[model samples]
Target chain A: MNRYTDEERQLDELLRSASPRRTVPPGLDTRIMARIAAHERRRRERRAIRSMALTCLALSAVLAVVGGIAVRSLDVVHRPETLVLLLAGMGCMALTVGGDRIGEIMRRL
Target chain B: MEQPTDNEIVQRVAAGDTEAFGIVVARYSEPIYHLVAGILRNEARAEEVTQETFVRAYEHLDRFRGGCSLSTWLYRIAYNRAVDSCRRRRFFGLLPAHETLPEPDDRPRYDDETIDRMRRALGRLAPRERALIALFYEEERPIAEVAAITGLSPANVKVKLHRTRQLLRKYMETQ
Candidate 1:
């Protein structure tokens, strides 16, 4: 243990003299910040696209249900898939609201 | 007013204040660069890896729960980035394993020539060993901090550090 201590001291001294602490080059912070800003922009764009898609899906689901109800009232169709339209609308609503949570889960994966 | 702490800076960044992250970059860029350069032995590559580390930290700022100090967290990220870069280089055969030099039976000296030998010896060490030396000696971090950066237990850090010290001594003392 004493020998280890002695060696450790010598090694520490040698490394200190040989490899002094380096200074970061000028503009490194700027370069890093630029990259970070670009990444943030890309992430925001992706989220916007996701939100738009979800909203479209929900709106389309709503239109399908309204059309089904109108057709049922018209009494022209023998069978109206009102139940399926309601289930689709509910699923799309959940997806639109829970999009962020789903994103977090996917990122973890 | 007194300077806000690292947690404060992290919180500000997480709160959508993008400019606040520049403070984190300015504060840790130097030591993180030094640690990465020591591990990589390449200044340009170290700079690139340092930038990547900060970007990664920024991206995950919301996930930082402050279980450890900001410096420790940054050091851990920097260390991992450096190691991953090394692995990728090795995988593509871009970096060759450093060859060991023959030993001589003379007392070690700390001259310029000896410094050159020390550098070569450092290059011969594994990336993880270099990281241990950088955090413990160059950065002057405690054993616990070193363990945190390397994801090793404190006892494991001590044992690995002891063996690395001996290996470095032997390599530098060689002809």
Candidate 2:
């Protein structure tokens, strides 16, 4: 049969009573919530910047494509070099705007 | 109203409901503070580390995979932060070495004076030993959970708990 020792029981009671439930300072929650709010704000700002950059890049690409098609259909000039340059510019813009996200996606895949 | 589970609260926080994290903070702050304070033996430093622990939990909410209860995960973070703070303090000679207590006959009872003395004796233990005693005896955490929080094996935790109890007993017996 298991037995209880005087020392063990005393130690248990001592530890339990000694380690009282500490009262968190009233301002701690406010401070933590404020920090969380600040973190969220920074995250939102980063997302906003990324989205704005992506939108501008997309608009530019679409405009370039439409203009290229229009020029070709109107027979204004057979500028293959201009079309190639536009495509290259769009590629660079995509890389610049979404390079990190694209890399992350690819890494995940 | 039935309170949400920790996973639900974590989901809300992960979904950008930053205020939802307050629920987690309210639930854990006291215990986390006590745990940190027990190890650091400095209320100010322990409070700071507890705050940092919550902030870290918020930042890493998405990475929580529900592998363990949120309390366990939170305790683990608090434990690590307290240990780090203790090490930094020791590095600067800020933490004093464990003091040798004068042995008294018989174990001390838990009167007000004895309790105060016990608190002092606890402070005289090594930081990790204090942490082990706090988690095991005061917190009443399961051995597995304590092991997970402290990164010790279950068997090792049991052995350490035994030794820490003996040390505490010795300290408490001191005048």
Candidate 3:
């Protein structure tokens, strides 16, 4: 047991001496801060694009609904098939307005 | 003026005062670098991993509930990052043969060739074991904190650390 303690002590000293505290390179903090800034900028840009895409999607849906109701109340089409066709046209318009935005958001993601 | 505690800095950063994060980065970067460099044994990769650790901690600050000290959380991130970097290097077969060998600066400081042997022995140990050594000996962390950083139970940490020391001794004797 005594020999073990002695050996452990020697090893401890040896390890300590062998592995001195490594010095960090200069400007490491600057480099890290720069990276953090870049990351923050990217995050902000992503959030802005996402929010804009959501707004466009909401606007397109509202326009489609309002356009459909207006056409239905006008009674321009006597047939249910005509009303369905009008709604489908409005739906196509909405997709045209918002499709690219959605695609952009998806690609970014 | 007294410097703010880590919790205080964290609160400030979470409150949208992003500059306060610089304090955390500056305060922890060196020790994180040492711990990471010890594990990866590559200064450049260690630096990159250290920066990555801070960036990850910043992004995930909301998840920090103060269950552990900030340094412990940061150490955990740095350790995992270094390990991942090591794995990636190994996968690409780009890991150097002497990744963990001691630097040439030690030649003048320690005249004994045993120091070289000891460093070579350290290189032979697995990366996880080297992490345990760095956290235990270099950081002088308590077993419990080491456990927290390494995701090991305290009992496991103790056993592994004991075995690591014994292995180091054996290597030193035989090498």
Candidate 4:
């Protein structure tokens, strides 16, 4: 075994004996659990909102496609208002589906 | 009753039994707090960082792949949080206040004066150096495990460990 110098031994003894041992605060558990609960709740709410938004966007896309087909079948695709409405609906659908991806890309930039 | 393993507890927490996480918090809070307090030397900030560490751990529980022991993983998270808190405080020109040593009544091994000297000497070291000392000596972690927790190569850890011990001894002698 390597022999420790007196100073090394003293320092080791001091480190072993005098290391600070802070008692965790009494209410730390309660505080952490409350924070965790809040976080879970917020995450659940966000997931709910995202799913709802996705459902709405899916419905909007279906409506836009159907409406576009109907307008084409009815020969009303020539009307500027119908065409604008169709384009806006399609744009909204794309934004809703790709919003998170767009945000990720922007952040990387 | 025998306690569940850390892996078991982690699996339970991931399965939505959030109460299982309380067991993890209870098991780790003291070491985590002590580690943070050792570096920051401020009880309030240490407590905050300790709490934040667990919160981050919980948030990323799924990412814990059991590559390291739970304690080591938790220490890694605590270490990062403490370093970040230290940096933020430094940026704001806020230095940690000198902390008082533990009361003699609490630790009958050393008198208040010796503990105080050691604490002061520890405080004089850089935050990472203090962390290295705490991990190696106070926590009784092996050099390899310390390297894993601190994200340092094992060889680097050995060099720093030797150098930090020398510095601590020098600092204490000067004090």
Candidate 5:
């Protein structure tokens, strides 16, 4: 029986044996690639959803800004109309930011 | 063209060149195998989990950002699956259900039967504890990476790893 602790030595041997460069079963490469392909497909789907969200946010920003600006010109209540437009602009920015944050989180897949 | 780097391979895989992913898998299979096998202590189960690791990684490949190292991401999947399998086995009473259990790797071989006694002693440690040793020694991961892979905070990992090492060292001594 090996009586001494030699724990440190044993550890070194263990580490060396387990190094990532060790040979694996043949054709594991193929299996892994097949797996990655499936994963990428899912990832692409998520990207599409995120793109859709971004598109909605952009359209909403333009509509809100243009409508708010045109309303201010016609109403003649410059202060209130201006304030509303600025608030709408801020809201659009926030919506875009929120969607971006969520998109980043979802991208974690 | 120059041989593609790991990052390049990953990016290509991300770009939907599925074959490039073979490089990634071939790169890590051996280590991942040892990681899961060492933790689960069942060669067959380890192989199953290792295969599942790739399957799960594939299922969620789109969400993988390059923030953390790719190896770290793969280790995280391996660790989580090992933990889940242990929990499921426990809950299902697939094991003793009542008898006191040993550490994972129910049948570790010892050299010339001299270390066979020590093998049983080592098996007394918990799966997570055993996992720490395997990660540190077999995976050659730094403490910080082990913390990330195991989902323990660095400080906590340090404490657990230190304590686990001491236990193994001491256990080996007495045997």
Candidate 6:
């Protein structure tokens, strides 16, 4: 064997150990799993609410169209030459986007 | 009776028994951790990377083809996560994500003879180079396995492994 220093071998021996590995705390798994479960619950609720909102908005849109048509038919019966009510309905439709000045933001978004 | 295979756990996880995935985490976390720690070197960040690996694995399990072993797939995820964590550490101007070895007299266990010196030397290598050495020395992967895990061809792995060793040797000698 090549000449070996005692101190060097001792140091090499000392440095050659590996620490025992510990797992991430068990609670970490529970917390993460719990969060995933809760997130799924929240996601379903959010999707349901979004679908309901879309349905309500669609119903409102259909009602607006039908009411405008009904008013136009009335205008024809009462004062056939007048564009007043139809023009008013057109203005109402222009303001169709309804939640707190949403029309202005919708143009940008 | 057969104990559950990783593929079985994975299939259950995909079928919506999210809690069933904890078994997968519990089983693989240590190997996944050592692999991450080997590459990134910070114990705390390695723990975070291990956790994120499972999270990403869960998120992407549907895309996992059964052609490869589960651990191989997880290694791929862990590797990508470690790389991202390394980038984040660098971008934040933090010290590279590596653990400080205790003094030889102080640390009870160290597998690398020059643990501290090697770590300091490792810093000089590019991340991919460091990763290759780590997969060899730390993860104990053979060149073939390392190539499979890192997606390098065996020939490329050998070439890269040679350069990696030379770079570390240079660092050790110079340092």
**Which candidate leads in DockQ?**
3
lDDT of 3 by residue, B1-175 (tens): 9999999999999898889999999899989999998888878888889989999999999999999999999999998988888888889999777874545454344566877787877877788998998888877889999999999999999899889989998877787
Worst 10 residues of 5 chain B by lDDT: B97-106
Q: Pick the winner on lDDT between candidates 3 and 4.
A: 3
Per-residue lDDT of A64 in model 1: 65
Lowest-sum lDDT 10-residue window in model 3 chain A:
A70-79
The per-residue C-alpha lDDT of model 6 at residue B121 equals 73
- Sort candidate 6 into its docking category: incorrect
Instruction: Give the top-scoring candidate (lDDT).
Output: 3
On residues A1-109, what C-alpha lDDT tens digit does candidate 4 reach at each position?
Answer: 9867887787787877667666667888788778888998888867766666666667667767787685676554567776777678767766777676555544544
Tell me the lDDT of candidate 3: 0.84
Report the poorest 10 consecutive residues by lDDT, candidate 2 chain A.
A100-109
lDDT of 6 by residue, A1-109 (tens): 8555675454334323332243444565665555556766865666666665675577578767876676656744566434566556655764564443444334433
Task: For candidate 1, give fnat to 2 decimals.
Answer: 0.75
**Candidate 1 chain B — worst ten consecutive residues by lDDT sum?**
B99-108
Rate residue B47 of model 2 by lDDT: 74
Q: Measured against the native two-chain assembly using Cα atoms, what DockQ does each of the candidate structures obtain, in the order listed?
A: 0.34, 0.28, 0.45, 0.38, 0.15, 0.15
**Of the candidates numbered 3 and 5, which has the greater DockQ value?**
3
Candidate 2 vs candidate 6: which has greater lDDT? 2
lDDT for each of the candidates? 0.81, 0.78, 0.84, 0.81, 0.69, 0.67
Residue A103, model 5: lDDT of 59
User: Candidate 2 at B76: error in angstroms?
Assistant: 0.8
Please give, for residues B62-143, the per-residue lDDT of candidate 6 as tens digits.
Answer: 9998877888888878887887778777788886444553233345455455666656777666667767766766566777
Poorly placed runs, candidate 1 (over 4 Å): A1-8, A75-109, B96-109
lDDT, residue B92, candidate 6? 89
- The sequence of per-residue lDDT tens digits that candidate 1 reaches over residues B1-175 is 7877899998888788899998888899998998898788777888999999999999888878889998999999999999999889988988865532223223345776877788788888888998998888878899989998899999999999888978888887774
Task: Give the Å shift of residue B125 in candidate 3.
Answer: 0.6
Report the lDDT of model 4 for residue A17: 68
Error of 4 at A80 (Å): 13
Tens digits of per-residue lDDT, candidate 5, B12-75, equal: 8668677776766777888888887667666567777888898787667777887788889999
Per-model TM-score of chain B: 0.89, 0.84, 0.91, 0.89, 0.81, 0.85
TM-scores, all candidates, are 0.79, 0.71, 0.84, 0.81, 0.59, 0.68
Q: What are the runs in model 2 whose C-alpha is more than 4 Å off?
A: A1-4, A49-109, B96-109, B172-175
